[model samples]
Target: MKYDFGEAIDRCKTNSLKYDFIEERGYPADILPLWVADMDFKIPHETAVAIKKSAEHGIYGYTEPKDSYYRALSGWFEKHFDYPIRQEWVLKTPGVVFALSLAVRAFTKEGDAVLIQRPVYHPFSHVVLNNDRKLINNPLVLKDGKYCIDFDDFEKKIVENNIRLFIFCSPHNPVGRVWTTEELTKIAEICIKHHCIVVSDEIHCDFVLSGHKHRILSSLSQEIADNTILCTAPSKTFNLAGLQAANIVITNPELRKQMYKELTRTGYSQLNSVGLAACQSSYEYGEGWLSQLKEYLGENLKYIRHFLAEHLPQVKLIEPEGTYLLWLDFRETGIEPSELDEFMKHKAKLWLNSGEIFGKEGLGFQRLNIACPRTYLEQAMIRLKTAIDSLL
Candidate 1:
């Protein structure tokens, strides 16, 4: 059951977004890509075996998920987090991002105000604007390099704008934070008071680090659950994002009805045969693989912490309670945004997500994907050290 995470798999010729799109991304070809959210590791062996078996039939006909697929989806939730999700509550979707847009269309009006925390996943804003909904920013507060909800500001925005919906990022991205039960309670109260429907994106829920547990926002209370639309997938956990599968869970009967109606209106298609096979195999047999991978990622985070401390002392490493993405604060490096981008591209030969893409709050911050082989990580660290040295 020992997985080979250290092996450098060749991904250049495979039409990889992380590899083949460098020129399109306006970065030098030699720059190592650490920008995309997907990891460089091979998909789980169990998932691969299942996919191959499903492909052997050689018929890519239209398909619907069998009972086993439903069981796998519900069983994983029940077994791991003890969250009981009935079969009736689950709605299949091709992608979480697509689901977000669908939820916006389903629940809100064209001009309805949708609130999103700043320095959040970039797509949250993109989807809202594209769907003709007014975007409201309730930026997270940076206190001691740890990000927390500005609840007072959140309440203010809800009241001031008559915000119709709130899109939340649990165990939030970039500045990784697993919102505690108390925080969730307060947030749920505010959303309820404002009569705002909540769309909680918990896609990265399972990849949390030690001492942190993911709290499903809807599970906190019945009223909160009624108004909440929960989105999740096995993509990040099992490294099967290419499978193009995700679940939209709504426990409230009326809300579920509305979402399904929207799904049909949008002409949302059925899940692919391979996606179903991969999801079943991953949910059933990929737990041990995930557990070990988390351990490896913990070590990777620790290595980055030490590297920054010993070498690039000017940069701040915000310790994450969840997710493999390391949010680096390079403000102290005093490099302009353009100069920093150049350094990462040319001098360091690394490609990380520019924080500015997230929001203005992300200025001088960069999100580094550390979910790769140790050798690759070490090389990236060396490049980072050299970049800083050149600046000095």
Candidate 2:
């Protein structure tokens, strides 16, 4: 690989949330942070160069994306994801979560229900509930260690609660499962029938593993496309989350207007200066880096599987079809949710996202981010094994 995936870069003193503020997050300063979604990898060389070039110019003014920005974004999607994104359909945001909150405020009124599938990204529920919207969850069924959408429960709840907006996580977070075209079609069909607007979070869409293919939820059909708000970002793909850049794509003019107005109320305008450069450069020049990173990440996943099999066989790694996050099931260990969290935090000295935070169904599960250097991952696993062995 041209890029060094094994290089361990110390993130301390960088004011990184995942690195610097471990104690504040309730983990020891010495804790191995394998929790956050951001990767330990550096941004592509070209993307770094672009940001550096802008910084050297010494003009720190509010900036917006030029034509090149849209071309880069559109070209990348067309080439990689097979989704043709029109320039007009794109709206820039600081981050996907911020955009999601804006979308909730725009599309749904307070007291209206918004549907989400759990265990999902915790922020999905946060955005809905924090906005005073009624949060409805149609939990995903874990069958044979793979997560499947509950289509009947999904539609039934939509009808019963009069859900106006649906936050759909494609290539879902925490629990990684890339929705197949057939699954996406069923969801779109439900949304269209229910007169619901689908806020499809496609941020992790680019991270699917070898066997699975990511189908753009909106790209399935025109009706789906018109009813969809496709939220995407180069942050997770290129490790530019600190720069805080994302794009929200809306094809329907009416829905687009509603979202745009909502965004304006939040006093949000103009993209981050460095973030735009990082995003454009990454899309135009970072595909090779991303391609190799995906392979390396697959290796990381394999390492985790083998490590657990040999050491902590009681813990099952839920097979992930996409994303670098691994959902580890510890039910066989007979650990309760709070106890499991304590074991990971205090006993293992490993900082991981407690599964119950995703939703109640995620009890006895822990989400470990495997997007870091292999050496650190090995250390984390050893720590975990030591903790488990203590129970024996």
Model 2 has an lDDT value of 0.90
lDDT of each residue in 1-392, candidate 1, tens digit only: 89988889989888887888878867777888887789878877898899999999899999998888888888888886778787888899988998898889988999988999999999999999999899999999999879988889999999999898899998788788999999999999888887888999998988887788888887887888898999998888887778899999999999899899999998877999999899999998888888888888888899999989988888899889888898999888878865777778888898999898899999888999988998888998888888778876
In order, what lDDT does every prediction score? 0.88, 0.90
Model 2 per-residue lDDT tens digits across residues 228-292: 99999999999998998999999999989998999999898998798889999999999999999
Best by lDDT: 2
After superposition, the stretches of candidate 2 with alpha carbons farther than 4 Å from their true spots are: none
Candidate 1 — which residues are off by over 4 angstroms? none
In model 2, the worst 10-residue window by lDDT is 22-31
Clashing pairs in 2: none
C-alpha TM-score for every candidate: 0.98, 0.98
Candidate 1 clash pair list: none
